[model samples]
Target: MRRAIILFVSLGLALGACDDTGATGTVDAVADVSADVSADVSADAVDTVASDAEVTGDTDAPSDTSAPADAAADSVAPVDTGPPPSCPEEAVTVYLYEDGNGASNSWYDQPLGSDDLPLSGEAVSITRPDGGVTAARDCGPGRYGFLDLPAGAYLLDVAVDGETTSHNLGRRLPRAVADGAVKLVAFGDSVPAYGPAPWFPEQLETLLAPFVTVTLSNVAIPGSQSSEWLPGGSNYVNRLAPHLADADVVVFSLGGNDLMNLASDFEVLGVEDALALLDDLDAAIVAIEANLLTIYGAVRAAAPDADVVWLVYPNYAMSDRWAQYLGDYQELAATLLASKLEGIRERMGDVAGLTLADMYGSLDKPALDAFLWDELHLNVAGHRYYAEEVFMTLGGVLVGPPTSRGVHRSIGFRP
Candidate 1:
């Protein structure tokens, strides 16, 4: 329970403050404490929405706190919306930090986007929502922009030294918005974003092109945990929420990396400490569920008309790396994890109004084996499978995939 408390206390203290200024100030205080006090906190996060224009951190909006969980669940409304409105245009600005986890959030929150120094003089390439690409020139300290570009969420790549970091960085500047276009925004972990090739969202866009003009942007980080994407988490503030204002369709793919961490932890634990590790798993689930509830609320509040796609995970049993180091307890560890995942899937199915895409249940056994890229992550073939399945399930009021293709073979992704 203390492990869960660490996460709750960090978020409650850091994000459960006032407006934007107070948010940052709370982060600074958490920093002054230590890891025990600061797990992850996004100063720019959106928790509760009083209006579309103004987003505030609602300490009572998530399930982490006992007082608000019942209220949040009871007050939940169905997802429904009319025709798209003429929203203001939006531009995004990128930021690079030498190291993350300073005043605003911990390294746990911002694995790539937190640091003390404002980064400049780096080369940035931004891919526009309509598949056009642009370059970002340094405007000032720790800031960059694309001159003469129209407002829309775009994918960004930043090269610092010799390493490349890709994400949909920065907030959307309300200059002009996409007109008569589908604003598809995605932010999550590497399941959809893993690539030397087109991502799952990109593949989905390709599948969607014949039906509608889709505008796409994805900020899927490689190693981020779900805890960091909570209402007050770093991914929420810096990577996810900023582009939500004009979103027509939003999809999320996370929880894989969090499971990877749990698996990795098992390798270092002794047989005697197995119970403690199980406790850790429970705490992690609590954090992820709380994070999801808050995230769902925030999305609904921010983009009431948007269609949400909750991309569930494929099978993790294909990867047995969790027990690779266990000499005698390999079977035990694997059994425990498999059982837990089953329960998770069932619970999600029972949850009302959650638009779940059960990628786990629908995956063909052969495809589950053939497409299990690098064990846990998916390869190109997997993305194609996901796109087709999700496309068929999308009865969303805002957008629907082409019906003629049906359950046939993928037409292949764009090069």
Candidate 2:
């Protein structure tokens, strides 16, 4: 009842406001005002004559002789600041996209991966660091742009498909044009890079396909010791180095294989040798941490501005499949995680330019068990979940369905 009352009052106020605009609502303004402006008396230009009553009265009722001077302008779209700050010049110049979904189709609902459909007329806004918001232009059916984005990173909120509320994409908008392909390079070991098909990197590419093109290069090799990707490691020069030049984003997970053999030595070497593996695990961990930092250095060296993310292995011993491989994979995974936080200061530093994604601490134990394909590798379900988290971890992903057709390039578009 209260809602109905509030709605009724709101509706009355809206109608009252519309009636006072020196113009009628959309239908009346287009119909009656167009005719009235045309019926201006032939005396002195068209705008001269007005009904005395309309001149004296405040309402939009047209004068018998002519419509008000501003009536013709009622047909015009509201003046806006033209293109958004980050909109690509090429997109605007080519005029490749259709003129938006228009007023009527603005609320059409489309699901993710529906790249075949024209970009919807979803409402978009960019909130500046200081919290000023700039709204979106209606140009869609493949085009969308924003207005007055300040010089700093801002939160982009878009109404997904036809949802009433806007969704914040957890991060700043990429500077590339809406349809431009975002290059994603995946590195490290089997945790996130497991392929054969449907790994996290691939799933991420699919999730974003409807909105933007993804150029994914998964460089993960199973049983890859982190050392293999370090400066002088076997795969460093050939597989990893060449790809970093222009990467937009890079994600990788390592550390498990580096320590697994040392951990297994605990079972084989009894007495003093076993004691050394026990007490000297710190030395190994420190070296592995250094290896990780060196690997990150290479990525930063090659693609300085790329968004780099490091995924830590989930607790593998939590799964029965992993029990046979390690002396105790669960305890070993946890020990490495805690020691990294406590003893290894380099691993525990600020986010800096590199982001560390903590899969070990974050993925719940049940998921660790359920997602495993073997002793350490994640299955398809696990891959999809990791992909979702990775997308979320790299700030936030855009909420609406991504586009199929790119403006300058014809990569992601489908029929």
Model 2 spans > 4 angstroms off: 1-173, 176-179, 232-234, 264-274, 323-351, 397-415
Error (Å) of candidate 1 at residue 107 is: 37
TM-score against native, each model: 0.50, 0.51
**Candidate 1 lDDT tens digits, 246-322:** 88777887776675566554532232243344467678777777677778788878887665667766444323322
Q: What are the lDDT scores of the predictions, listed in order? A: 0.46, 0.45
Q: Give per-residue lDDT, candidate 2, residue 358.
A: 44
Best by TM-score: 2
Candidate 1, residue 78: Cα displacement in angstroms equals 31
RMSD for each of the candidates: 20.2, 28.7
Question: Per model, how many backbone clashes are there?
Answer: 8, 7
Report the number of the highest-lDDT candidate. 1
